[model samples]
Target chain A: AQSVTQPDIHITVSEGASLELRCNYSYGATPYLFWYVQSPGQGLQLLLKYFSGDTLVQGIKGFEAEFKRSQSSFNLRKPSVHWSDAAEYFCAGVRGTSYGKLTFGQGTILTVHP
Target chain B: DAGITQSPRHKVTETGTPVTLRCHQTENHRYMYWYRQDPGHGLRLIHYSYGVKDTDKGEVSDGYSVSRSKTEDFLLTLESATSSQTSVYFCAISESGQNSGYTFGSGTRLTVV
Candidate 1:
């Protein structure tokens, strides 16, 4: 079955510390990947996406994700975390052979500690 | 943010009642989608419309229905609401197919009591 998995259900880090959220996918081949952030009581906002080309993709709010084909991982990373970044993070992917529908992983809830 | 809008930012209805959620877009996108967000399950696609009248079922489309009669509006109807249908609903739009990306609306929080 094709699916995306986020191993960490919840993560906590100091406000100024580094942050990394893991995402792995099960697919026949390379798939289109994306990272989205959802603030409380708000809709999701696209943090970044990886279609093709470079592995390291930059997105808004100083967030970046690297797509590693060997590991089947597309982990989201931030050099320094902010308190405002505390929210639910989801990783989604689309199979190359399918339509525009998406398969999303169980989201990771980030908590920023002071 | 301003391109897509969802009606009744929040709604509560009794079980077995008919409920309808509306998604309106001004971007003139060709594809529209409805998804339900639940705890521990992320977001599941309920239904999607490729064109005005073209619609298809998604992974969890068992108890939901959708209609797209015009280019800018998509409606999701719950013929008979159930307790399991209480979830946050989000509507997204794409300029074209092939999963280029999606722009989502603010989302509607629906509760069935």
Candidate 2:
């Protein structure tokens, strides 16, 4: 069974500090990876996706993610975090042979402190 | 957001009552999906439709059912709601299944008392 794991349940970072949210997956083959952010009282928005391209992918709001095949990981990163960046992040993916079905991680609640 | 919409943004109903949530899309996507978002579960697929009248169960389809009678509408129904079924439900659409990513709606928050 394909699964996504976000090890950090919650992360607190100082505003203007660098941030990294870890994400790992388990699949027999290469999968389509994505990062989504959900702000309070808002729908989930696509941050970035890794299908078949450069390992380093850029997304909205100055966010980026690196897909590491050997490590089965697609981690989200930001060089300088903003207070508005406080929100829940989810990592999702589907097996190479699968359809539009997505396996999502447990999500990480990010809190930014000024 | 613009293409997809969910009705009854929030609702409270008694346990054992039947509740239906509506997902409407104008993007004419070929694939539609229903998922439940819980505190610790992130999002779990309840069901999905490939085309009109073509549906399939997902990982968590025990207490839920779905129907897609038209290209623009996908409805998710809870036959008999339960307290444990209280969750925020999201609807997503994809222009191409498996090959493309999905667009999600604002979500419907359902509370079963």
Candidate 3:
């Protein structure tokens, strides 16, 4: 069974401040990792994904994630956050065999303040 | 956006009544999934369809059933609504592959009284 763990339940940051959201996964093999964002009353949107190459994967809205195989972690990072970036973030992992089913972690709610 | 839409954006129902939620997609993706989102639990998959008339149970599929008779539609049915079932449901679509990113619908909020 694959599981994703997000340590932070909520985080607050000022506008233009750096942000990092931690995520850890437990899977037997090399897993496919992804980050998704959801606003209130909206569906989730994919931020980025990590398949194999490039430990650091860049995503939309100036978001990026680093897949650290050693630590079993994929942490999302942004140099500067905007107020509009306030949303819920989820980390998910998929085994190589499963077609589309994703195991998602408890999301981290991000609050961006001016 | 993958053209996925969930019907009855908001629904209020009584317990013991049957409720069916519809998920329609214009992208014609091969994979469709039903998930429920609750406070603190994030999103948990209830069911998924790989193709027309082919479906599978997900992690939290005990009280739910699903059907996919066409390529563009997947329906999730709760035989008997329970107060525990009140939550936001989301529909997602993905292409036929392992690495494809999922596209999700806005979501349907169902409240059972």
Candidate 4:
């Protein structure tokens, strides 16, 4: 069975500051990883996904993540965050055998201050 | 956007009653999924469909049943609504391969009293 862990439950950062959200997964094979963002009372939106390729993958809203196989981590980062970037972020992975089933992490709530 | 829409954006039902949530898509995607979002448990998949009339149980499908008679619509039914089932349900669609990411609907917030 595959699982995802997000170490931070909540993080607060000031506007224009760098932000990083940690995500770690346990999978036997090379995993298909994804990051999703959700605002309050809204459905999740895909931020980025990593199947196989460059370690650093860029996503919408100026967000990016690095897939580190050695550490089993795919951390989301933004050089400078805006207040509108405050939201809940989730990490998910798909089982290689399963067609489209995804296991998601607990989620990390980001609060951006001006 | 994948042109997915979930009906009854908000619903309040009583325990023991049956509730069905409808998900409609215009993108003609082959894969559709149902997921419930709770406070501490991000999102848990309840069911998914690969094609017309082809559906499978997800990680949390015990109290939920899904049907997909058409390629553009997937319905999720709660046999007996319970307080524990009160949460935001999201419908998502993906293109038919591992390379594509999913597009989610706004979500349906169901509250069971």
Candidate 5:
């Protein structure tokens, strides 16, 4: 079973500040990783995904994540934070033989302040 | 954005009553999944279907059942609704297993009292 861990339960960042949400996964082989964002009462929106190729992957809303095999981490980062970025972020992964089932982390709630 | 819709955006059902949640998709994705999101549990899969009649259980499949009669419709049934089943249920569609990621539905808030 592949499991994901999001070290931070809550993160607060000031407007225009750089942001990074950590994500760690435990799997036997390389896993397909994804980032999702959700507002208070809405469904999840895909941010980005990484399987192979370039280590750095860019996503919408000026978000990006780097896949580091050595550390088994795929962390989401943003150069500048916006007040509208306040939402809950989730890190998920899927193993090859697991079909389409996704394993998600506990999630990290982001709060942006001005 | 993948044309996925979960019926009864919000519902409150009494305990011991049977409730069914529907997930209809226009995207025609091959894979459909049912997940429940709790306060600290994130999203836990209940069941998933790979094809019209092929389905499999997920991690938390103890008290839930799912069926896919058509390619676009996946139904999740709570044989007998319980308070423990009260949570935000999400339906997600994936064209393929891993490469395409997934597009999620708006979700259905089910409350059992």
Candidate 6:
């Protein structure tokens, strides 16, 4: 079974500051990873997904993540954070015949301050 | 953006009552899923349907049941609502294959009293 772990429960960053949210996964083979963002009382919006190739994947809202197979981590990063970026972010993975059933992490709440 | 719709944006039901949540999709996705979200838990899958009349249990499928009569409609039922089932339920749709990430519905907030 594939599982995801997000070390940070909450992250606070100043506007225009670079931010990074760490995510680690445990899968037997190459995994399909994704990042999703959810605002207050809203559905999840996909940020980006990684299937294969291009370790560095860019996503919507100027966010990007790097897939490090050695460490089994795919960390989300943004060079400049906006106040509107405050939301809950989730990291999920599907691996080893997991058709579309995603194993999601506990989630990380992001707070952007000016 | 995947043309998914979840009915009853907010619902309040009494304990021991039966509640059904509907998920309708226009995207014609082959896979549909039901998940519940709580404070500490991110999203726990309740059930999933791969095709019409074909369903399977998820990690948290003890008190919940699901049915799919058509490709576009998936229904989730709580046989007897409980306080533990009071949470936000989200419906998601996805196509078959890799990298085709799941598209989520707005969610339905169900409160059991």
Candidate 5 lDDT for residue A31: 92
Model 1 bad stretches (over 4 Å):
none
In the range B1-113, model 4's lDDT, one tens digit per residue, is 44999999999999999999999999989999999999889899999999999999988999999999999999999999999999999999988745677889999999999
Give the DockQ (2 decimals) of all models: 0.70, 0.77, 0.79, 0.71, 0.90, 0.69
Each prediction's TM-score against the native?
Answer: 0.98, 0.98, 0.98, 0.97, 0.98, 0.98
- lDDT (0-100) at residue B32 of candidate 2? 96
**Model 5 pairs in collision:** none
Query: lDDT order of candidates, best first?
Result: 5, 2, 1, 3, 6, 4
lDDT at residue A74 of model 4 (Cα atoms):
97
Residues A1-114, model 5: lDDT tens digits: 679999999999999999999999999999999999999998999999998999999999999999999999999999999999999999999998787799999999999999
Ranking of predictions according to DockQ: 5, 3, 2, 4, 1, 6
lDDT string, candidate 1, B8-84, tens digits: 89999999999999999999999999999998999999999999899999989988999999999999999999999
Please provide, for model 4 over A1-114, each residue's C-alpha lDDT reduced to its tens digit, 9 standing for 90 to 100.
789999999999999999999999999987899999998887888899999989999999999999999999999999999999999999999866677778899999999989
Give lDDT tens digits, candidate 6, residues A5-112.
Answer: 999999999999999999999999989999999999899999999999999999999999999999999999999999999999999998847658988899999999
Q: After superposition, how far is residue B67 of candidate 3 from its true place, in Å?
A: 0.5
Model 1 chain A: lowest-lDDT 10 consecutive positions? A94-103
Interface RMSD of each: 1.3, 1.0, 1.1, 1.3, 0.6, 1.3
Native-to-model Cα distance after best TM-score fit, residue B35 in candidate 2, in Å: 0.4
**Residue A102 accuracy (lDDT) in model 3:** 89
Give candidate 1's chain B TM-score.
Answer: 0.97
lDDT: worst 10-residue window of model 5 chain A: A94-103
Worst 10 residues of 2 chain B by lDDT: B93-102
Collision count of model 5: 0
Residue B80 of model 4, lDDT score: 98
**Model 3: per-residue Cα lDDT over A1-114, one tens digit each:** 789999999999999999999999999998999999999888898999999989999999999999999999999999999999999999998898886788899999999989
Model 3, residue A33: C-alpha shift (Å): 1.0
What docking grade applies to model 2?
medium
